[model samples]
Target: MVGRKPERKSAPPTDVRAHVLASATRLFAARGFDGTSLQAIADEVGVAKPSVLHHFPSKEALRASVLDNMLAHWSEALPRLLLAATAGEGRFDALVGELISFFAADTDRAKLLVREAMDRPDEVRLLLTAQVRPWQTAISEYIRKGQRHDEHFADVDAEAYVLHVINLVIAGLAVFDTFRVLLPDASVAESRARYVTEIIRIAKSSLFAGPALSAEPRDPSLEGAPNRRNGTTR
Candidate 1:
């Protein structure tokens, strides 16, 4: 009896489910939908394949569950974030900050969305309608409010601005690897801070009716820059 070891207790169902979802999220982000399997998810979660299926009936179902859970989280949080933005001095900046922080909190989430959209458009659409589109619609309304009330937003098209902001936040995080390389001198924290500042600055300039924030003249060394998108010189 003295030499016997105490038995280890198994995690409850909720904990196991969360673990499975987390492991699946990481796997799906790193490996495309076709690249990952239920067995691999089971192995990562230290559960039997059947156990995983018990919580999620099939592979598609599991992926949906993961995305649904993430979306549910955002759905709950959005109201509070919007409220904060409304109460803040710089409402637009505050909203952008909240968004940047949200995606930055879970770097894998954006990557997962990007990968899934590219690989499994059908599945992505399901999630987009259920979760993403609602948020976009709400934010679009908020942008419209700013356009009506805020001096900076008065000239901007609410729809186009909403799309630009969403793309900037998601695409920036989705392609952060390239950002890291391009910003070799900055730490991740610095890069994120700088990026957020720049985004907010650009948004304000584009929307807000004000003089340019910087007073310095343009550098004469590069007077004529080529516009890559249209192949024109500026």
Candidate 2:
């Protein structure tokens, strides 16, 4: 059991690149992109800087690659989650739940994501376009599609709603580090579910109510909220 020979194992180029990206995601989250050096990323991945640079030309490039990968992962996972996310489970809550779950599940990735979204705003527009929509325009547009057939509230503005949802999701993650200090005992799952449930209640009452629910005493919990068609969160 003493001489383990380092548990020798190897992977293909794609796998290696993924490994580098995952390592960089964690390091960059802890240390900013500028703070995290190529050498440091390479060291964490147990590879040479030259090897890292061979796969990715620069540190920023590597970070961007990780972001891009995550975006792709979300694009694929969203629909499945929306479908499986039941009404009993709280569709509105589920949207919030999923976003928080995503970031909470990947602390380093979440940190890297929020930093890039806020800091490198200029570089992202086109990169995000190609990565998420490509030929589809933008994620905001895709989100708007739900409103056409009353999947969501018809009165709600699509762009506004999309931005609101995106914010609710990412904001949970953005505050994770700070919240860590406050809710140290709360698991990522708990914080996300609670926050998402709160956000959905706010959105449904204020964002979608159109003065109806406002006239009445809104339930603090979304348990009594009405359901929408198409499995969409009302």
Candidate 3:
């Protein structure tokens, strides 16, 4: 007797939805939200327009879903890394490294965020209030806590420092495409590493207004086993 052929399994619904969201993120990042359409997202995902609609009813809905996912990841990841660090220097270095990796993973997020800040101020305002503000506030609080505990961090202005750090990270990654072209010899990975190194240097040298920090940079990998700190998983 002949055996039956193995049946091929279809992707799960969640997987399908995730693929669509990933396609939408790429499109929205490159084309801007208004420039990217539902049909385009469907085409990019190789799914029918109705299928895309089933996952995300409208362009705005899709954009919201994408932003929500990005915000959720950053909000959780940043806090976890910060809390995991045993000291202020460690926390600061981890923060810089993570920010570099986050934006470097996709330039679109950086571009989309900067564009939305200018083009759709109200949407940005809502995003900040709902997601970003809380994480940022926590980081600021951590900086302030360091200032209180360590003389070396005495003159650090938590608010200004955080804002400037964000601006530097986002701005660098946003324009990195051009930088890659300009320095064609450098692979994207090489460029990112170099940029992160420079960012770490700046943070260590300029951000603190106190005595000179140790000349050595902290470990870039920020390796640690899974652990808990301040009630957060780290």
Cα lDDT computed for each candidate against the true fold: 0.69, 0.62, 0.69
- Once fitted onto the true fold, the runs of candidate 2 whose alpha carbons sit more than 4 angstroms away are 1-15, 81-91, 127-158, 184-193, 208-234
Query: Every model's Cα RMSD, please?
Result: 9.1, 7.7, 9.0
- Highest TM-score scorer: 1
List, residue by residue over 135-156, the lDDT tens digit for candidate 1.
Answer: 6777677667656665454667
Q: Which stretches of candidate 1 lie over 4 Å from their true place?
A: 1-14, 122-150, 153-155, 215-234
Cα error, candidate 1, residue 184 (Å): 1.1
Clashes in each model (backbone N, CA, C under 3 Å)? 2, 0, 0
The TM-scores, one per candidate, come to 0.74, 0.63, 0.72
lDDT of 2 by residue, 23-128 (tens): 7877777878888888777776667678899889876678778777877777777785566355453555555556556665666656666688777887666655
Better of 1 and 3 by TM-score: 1
| Better-scoring candidate (lDDT), 2 or 3 | 3
